[model samples]
Target: MYSDDIAIRVNNLSKCYHIYERPQDRLKQSLYPRFQQLMGRQPSTYFREFWALRDVSFEIKKGETVGIIGRNGSGKSTLLQIICGTLTPTGGTVDTRGRIAALLELGSGFNPEFTGRENVYMNGSILGLSREEMDARFDDIAAFADIGEFIDQPVKTYSSGMYVRLAFAVAVAVEPQIMVVDEALSVGDIRFQNKCLRRLDEIKASGCSILFVSHSSTMIESFCDSVVWLEQGEIRDSGRPNEVVRRYVDYMAHGVNDSGNKSVFDIGIETEQSSNGWEWIRITDQNNVRALDDYAFKRIRVKVGEEPNASRLPCEPTVIEIECEFLALKPIEFPLFAVGIFNELNEPVIHCNSNNLGTRMIPIVDGQLVTCHFKATIPGLRPGKYLLAIGMDEGLLGAHQLLCHVYDAWVFQVLSPRSGRIQGGYVQVQDATINLQIMKGDRQ
Candidate 1:
């Protein structure tokens, strides 16, 4: 049993399956164990043991949203199935504090032979809701699902998208204290996915614990309070969403151990200094190719405000200047220079371009040493490491030829402010002024 504050507690949980090399081996595995037991001999396994999960332990506190991420066959689905009580673990214990609504598989809880209306009530009953309660919520569920007349049709006739829509509708309509989702939202259309995300945010705001599984690191980092990285059925890392997701991404990209060297994108921390006290770091040596045209980025450097060595803080005044030098393989007319800053999750937080600033640029000839300069007052980004990207293109916004774009061209850090602090959000707006107005009530 778990404490009241713990929504779901899984202790030393594990699940294993028998892997047979041939079809007949499954039959052998099933009968040989019983026969050996009856013959007063030890039962022998005809199949190999595949542990989908091994000694996995974690707790989801009530009202906390936790995300699970891993590559395919890493036991992410198996772990969620066990936690949702659809699959029993081979070892360890699972405890729950409240009603759980899960959308693990498409149409998992629905009866394919039954109508969508019938399945809705059936699912509600399984979740311990009375028929009367379901009846009152039926209209709302149907509206949310937007299945139209298909609600009266058999579930077997429904498309994959329709099935998920109705299932998500029923799951959220039940007002569960805990929600378990396993990438089912990816089935629906973009509009539906956004709608479900908004509803999920509402559910989290209502004090319901959520366990979400997705391959999207940005979603996990932005949405979940904490993250768990599962690798080969074991907990590889578990902690804050940003740190764990970063490591998971690094592992995925490099396919190396976490104890390995810094990631390819992380090489910008090492800077080279000149005798004149100017330091420049390499973001990446890769060249961006577009339309069979290749432009080589020779160098890119950043200067923070007036001081090249000044430290930027959250909610502070800062001007960012980016200088890029590239070799144009072909002639380009009026090339556009752009700079982008991304967070640890690689999501762009701020972007500026020469066109946006209404700047005029000169043309580039073949084998030209193209130098681009960008100057802007950068926003008050969160206190963390930020990646800088530089891109050079030609032509209009919608129709343009990308000559070269260097991602992670440079990396910078924003320090915490000594006077104040900006916590919990990505960007903090500078200069705050509060105004209060009170009106007096009059009586007749």
Candidate 2:
């Protein structure tokens, strides 16, 4: 039930998209009236109608934070667009209170021709802020953005990071009653992301309703007060943030990794406590152990959300990608890396890009994000606490070199599952494939 203090109410809102047979049908529909009079309402040339959203409804309290999640193409973006007044709903309506500020994309409202100062003022006006009002908040905005002297420089000349800093600063400064944030927050460095998160928390404390959409479940769990899940344009679950995200992660891991069959639904994730939360070991390599003197490749450690790794994997990876909360020594080039898996003797298990998989040719820039995938087809490694080696290796042909370890990383256990199925396996790679046929009807 939506209490009297509700700030937004969405009732049976839906959006439909028509798939056209030919590209020209769009133009025809726009001008169909001129020639369709003789035909008395010609049937739509497009043969398909896809409902991007179906019978979706939710209510937000005055200062509640809501998270929206679904697989790609599940209408998450469309719903946000409708709420932000960027797109119209095919059915139903969204009722909201007060002015709204949206950061659907970084620099969406920027004019490349203008300096950051001018764009800030112009975007502020568009968001309903007056000159005097913006001027009063300008100092706070600039200090929060911390983009140096670039605020007076043309937006076109700003780096991607600088642009994001400025755009986000302005949006938060305008002080709208409702604010919508998309995944663009993933682009910035860790420090900036943390700053933004703190500001968002401050805004929430100030009684502003916020809507957030991100692929990372950890981010959702740590941030949103409540969560809503959408599947194939329909609402699947709406309630606690912890419950919904666990389901989404389960849905993503099914078939690719392990799935708990006891649940009625496919995408439900079961939670349990852990020591610092390092359960599944992802990186592996037994060879190329770094001696204390090996300094060919500089070591680059990882920090969550920026630096080398994120706190959570964007998707339910076949292998468990551990959280990185620390970094190593001084900065190197652009592609520092950490690899983990099983090692022989003391060798690292996996590489920056495994050469055997033809991925070794790719150079890993220092602190760049690289996801190393593995096939868990061969199981039965002796169970114990195994260490996943984090290090730098020079790939084949020196195409790109992995300098060194950002951190020593952590360890995980391989235990036995009850059903004779291997337990603690990181991936769900098919164990075997079998085919049977009746030979010349003899069996029959």
Candidate 3:
């Protein structure tokens, strides 16, 4: 028996494949096994057993989104395929309720010879949609895909992005009770990806469960209600997205090291890889002299604590200190310094500058090394990795000449708060005080 509230349940699920040394070995195993069985003898094994997943178990509640993360061969895809019923599990049982729409491999159910229009109908039928139902939704699906006239053309002529566009369009149009997505969305353009994300948000809001798999920590932490971390085909950890993702990242960066005891940021004076080691991959280029504009970032250093830059709790009072040196090739005046802290998605979550703070800097002469320091308190940012960027410009805020700028200048981590979990959003308001005034009133 299965509960109505449980969208998916897997118990002791395992999948194994036979690894043959050669083509002849596969043939021999198929023939010899049957011959041994017929002769009343034990079958001789001719292949090695490779267990892709072993004793994996979990539950996805109705309307809850879960994220699965692991290394390349950590069996993420295998697990998803089993849950989607495309691959049979060698052992254990999987029970799922309601209609399932999945975007597995790129063009998995698509036929190269069939037109995009034809494949959409075929996929819809596979998802338990009637011909009439698909007919009603076909125009909307075609418009969402935005492939234009290519919808009538063969699927083989479409690019990888186009295939995903059409497939995602069809999948979402089904309005399934459960949505399973692999990393196929990564192939689409930013606009299409955003569109898909918006659609997914709508699905989730409608009480549909989602199983998302991605290598991006930012996406998983921001999108998932819960996360499952798999290691070597087994469940390593499962719980809140922030905690699980932090552990996973720590292990990936420094395996077997006591992550709890060690700090992620090391601000030593002369360490092998100091904060100053970050190279400035300039984003802007110009053939004119303005691009060459006599200014260059020489070095940068960030300090979060006296010991080292370690994980911080939410709502913790954090003072970010930045020291940077620059070489001014020309005379610079009223230099404005900006420090930006970006999240994993490269979105600026925190931006502070001297101009905003009303701190005016003195003028600088050519061939001079200008050193500046910046200090600011970071609000209650959600637990995740953050990157630091620095920018220097001469003149006023509205109109200024770019002197130098470098992104990913430094890195830091924010751990979950001990008192409570600050869920969702980029930054939380610090030290908030609530004053409730109760007034007598009558219900009208």
Over 59-156, each residue of candidate 3 has an lDDT whose tens digit, in order, gives 99999999999899999999999999999999999999989999997869799999999999999888888999999999999999999999999999
Instruction: Note the Cα lDDT for every prediction shown.
Output: 0.81, 0.64, 0.79
RMSD of each: 7.6, 21.4, 13.1
Which segments of model 3 are wrong by more than 4 Å?
A: 37-40, 256-444
What TM-score, over all chains together, does every model reach?
0.71, 0.57, 0.64
Task: Provide backbone clash counts, one per model.
Answer: 1, 27, 0
Q: Which window of 10 residues has the lowest lDDT sum in candidate 1?
A: 283-292
| TM-score quality measure for candidate 2 | 0.57
**Considering every candidate listed, which one attains the maximal lDDT?**
1
- Quality of model 1 by C-alpha lDDT: 0.81
Candidate 1, residues 173-218: lDDT per residue as tens digits? 9999999999898899999989999999999999999999998888
Give per-residue CA lDDT, model 2, range 1-444, as digits (tens): 546688889999999998888888778776765567668875445347899999999988888899998888999989998999989999998999878888886657799999989988998889878899999999988898898899899999988888888888988999878989888688889999999999999999999999999887778877999889888999877667655665455456421122122221212222233455423323221112232233332222222223223222221222343332222243334333345554212223344434444543345444445443333222344333344445444534357554444222443444443355543333333455779975675554
- In candidate 1, stretches whose alpha carbon ends up further than 4 angstroms from where it belongs are 37-42, 254-275, 280-301, 309-340, 348-385, 389-444
Q: Which one is best on TM-score?
A: 1
